[model samples]
Target chain A: MFDTQSANFDVQGLSVALIQAELGRREGGIPIGSALISPLDPDVGTEEVPASGRIYIHGHGRNQRLQKSSAILHAEMDALEKAGRLAPEVYKKATMFTTLRFASYVHKCMCTGAILLYGIPRVVIGENTNFKGEEDLLRSRGVEVVVLDNQRCKELMREFIRYHPEEWDEDVGGSKETSARAS
Target chain B: MFDTQSANFDVQGLSVALIQAELGRREGGIPIGSALISPLDPDVGTEEVPASGRIYIHGHGRNQRLQKSSAILHAEMDALEKAGRLAPEVYKKATMFTTLRFASYVHKCMCTGAILLYGIPRVVIGENTNFKGEEDLLRSRGVEVVVLDNQRCKELMREFIRYHPEEWDEDVGGSKETSARAS
Candidate 1:
């Protein structure tokens, strides 16, 4: 449950591994960041048995921070509503939802920070205006999408090389040596 | 190296566990697809090597069949050039650059297939798109991102009864219940 949106997909048991791989790795033994939980989501109330058991969501920039905070408040209201812990009127009054767009500054800074720090490859997404900037940022560092296929096998193949460069070719065969060379 | 551009990146000293967790479990099985050494890439230049060490790249689709075929031929030529097995004119003539792109039909099909088969609780990204589609599909599955995030940490707190459902939770965390669960 590293990201709340992930839950709505068919995790097929991969979610746990994704979380472990991300959070367990450390540079200097410092945890990167804790996973954030979202309460506004519908699944939060389905299986509640404890006051402390909470869900988490993943976020990074200023927008992510805003999203995380929003999630927290949403969750609190959810918890209250589920437990019959809040007055109906109060819960109704608190039902306002705010949608926050990704902040430009934060996106630029964090995306740059990720590239600078890890040289890790990321899949860039945006409209025509931002696409070039994002693509340039990633491409300058030697990251770009080389294939998009209809088959799951092809997608998995691409992901394999992206995640495991050593076992595969860094570039020639989708391996990490390519990343090493680029870095 | 999942993508051609990754061949230029620097990814060294990263963990194998992290790679395995991210890419997919090994489970001691042969990979589904084969890897081949292609001559289209600039990396190959006539290095004497055993056939077993070489990788294969398949040409699955119709549109790019010729390019894919040519790429392999080009890689072989490059290998020869680097190894001093081929003449300089060959290098100048064969050095054709090719970048892979997924056709729109294929891209759409893949996204659609993932949704129909896996449902939500899964997020997919192509070289160009992230959070692409099927948000509504995920909503129907009751998978929500928040729940997935909660599931991410559920293992650490498995000692608590409520954190994991009796059926879905596993024995990664050592507990007295582990025995029964394993059984």
Candidate 2:
């Protein structure tokens, strides 16, 4: 009952509709599912998105136009996709819902951008200036955001593996961590 | 408009409802959003799952209990969570869906498992033995299934980076290749 697609990509700002438009132009693939996934902020990225992108978390259902998703931790996942760091199918899946890909707003790539991890370990945090005002919201939730450059994210993951080393084992599907552990 | 939770975790197979019950027990988190994120085979992982977990993809909307979601790609994210490789919120977020954690089903700790990737670059493919009979279905899609072990995935990825070195840039999030290349 929730698989909705939009023919109206003309809507302003980011949404499943707009991202679908973005995906089609960039990847030559079509988005699946049902939903009118639109951006809560009709004027997002106007004066808000810093040059890099924002990684914010929100209850997408808390918004009006989306009910199919509960969150979109937007980071640079799309940039990761464009850079060939991931598959188009994976990127396409992230666009099916609204709240989760909000993290995609902050980055250099326009067609697709970044994504973030809310409550995920090995967070690559930097200046909250990129996140608009969501940093304060995150702080209110008692999350500790820190510096996460390539080096820092690597260090953080090293710390993570120290606690969960099996995440490095191949059969366990630890490749995700193996790939992300910053080597 | 589709949300169903079950106190009946005793069903014969995997379903989003059973996974939700399992998540609450393991992580003390509740899944959000509408849809029944379950396995296609009611009797999965019985004899079909090899010593390792399976990585299969499908139209999640194909089931009746799942009306809001379109897919779930189970992999290894759960092992990371059980090992505390991730933060609680991210783990909690994952409980909102299913897939990647499926490897968790094959390993030491198993409360609930599986996850779905949004959109990333390299997709690690292997056999679909865990998927019951969907191997033929996926074959029809013209996707090639290969044997992926630690060494093979490493070799293939190395070959990939050699051809697409731009993916190796530190800022690009190809840290997997970054670390492995050194090894």
Candidate 3:
């Protein structure tokens, strides 16, 4: 939802979008139901497909057109093709709608950057690719990535244990007053 | 929009409707044509008002239900009120829509039990009387109002300065390497 391809880029002010979604069926979550998912590139001579499986990640440079990030966008396009969809006009409208909506949130985030440990924790897009490529690109851009490696994880735990302090201080004793009473 | 009156709280979530109206205008930054204002009570009654003069904030939280916080919920609510008035039923439905849609985000922030700060910047919420008592109550509850006075503001600026030391270090040396450059 947050990716902006060059075509929709603000010729004026730059902006970023952060897509947020929730899936649940309870008092505090969305009731399981249909979600309005838009097909990717609903241009003429395109097919329509269900937008519920797989994922997609798309990107565009400053001059590139229509940037998308997320496995979902691709799946939508695939769905359209598989379903032989013909709603090119509707798809185009949906694309613009999503872009504008996402851009608004992104603009808000970028304009008022939040304080974070290392540059605001952001979903950065270096090059749109598969999950692994995306992860690598983000890491290359100085983003921290946690990989599940048993040995490495164990080493980290060991190092942490080595540096653990022995001295412990809790408010157990009543301080000077308690010491005096004891004496 | 961050204000407090008595105990019952009036929390406002960001609204997509407002964003669409504000940015979807042909006038760009000019006043939108005939703003739709609605005065709706969650408890009872509904009235629609029109745009006049500068954008104004007008909404009720039923009884004394505004709470004091630096969060953007109230500001967003005020923005919606200024842009278009929603009938109580419509407002409630919209609120539900947002809550369900962004439940995960809300849950994550709420779970941390920490005050949240998020929304469009450069949006100034007018000084409100309803917030005074609520702020006092919040201080008593150990919530830190980070920018309460000049001294605190200065301290915060210094902290940011420290965090972005490389920006300052670009000239000579002194703690240059220790500070990472800002983008």
lDDT of 3 by residue, B1-183 (tens): 222231311222112222322332222221111111122332233353322222222321100001221111222222332323222233322221011111112211110011111211111111212123222321333332221122322332245345544322221112233223211
Interface RMSD of the predictions, in order shown? 23.8, 15.2, 21.6
Per-residue C-alpha lDDT of model 2 across residues B1-183, encoded as one tens digit per residue: 122233332121134323433343233222211122222222233245322222222212111111211112112222222222222122221222232111112111111112212211112232222223222311232322222232322343344335544422222222343334322
Q: Which ten residues in a row have the lowest lDDT in candidate 2 chain B?
A: B102-111
> Which regions of candidate 3 are displaced past 4 Å?
A1-101, A104-106, A110-112, A115-119, A122-183, B1-56, B59-183
lDDT of 1 by residue, B1-183 (tens): 232234321121011112322221132111011111222333344353323332223111111111221111111112221222221112221211111111111211121121222121322111112122323432343422211122212222233224333321111111224324322
lDDT of 2 by residue, A1-183 (tens): 122133322121134223432332233221211122222222243244322222222112111111211112112222222223222122222322322211222211111212212121111232222234221322343333233222322333344335544422221223344224322
Question: For candidate 1, what is the TM-score?
Answer: 0.18
What's the iRMSD of model 3? 21.6
Model 1 C-alpha lDDT per residue in residues A1-183, reported as the tens digit of each score: 323235432232223222322332222111111111232332233244323333323221111111221111111122221222211112111211111101111212222222222222322221122122222433455443222122332233344435644432211222233334322
Which number leads on lDDT?
A: 2
lDDT of each candidate versus the true structure: 0.22, 0.24, 0.21
Residue A171's lDDT in candidate 2: 16
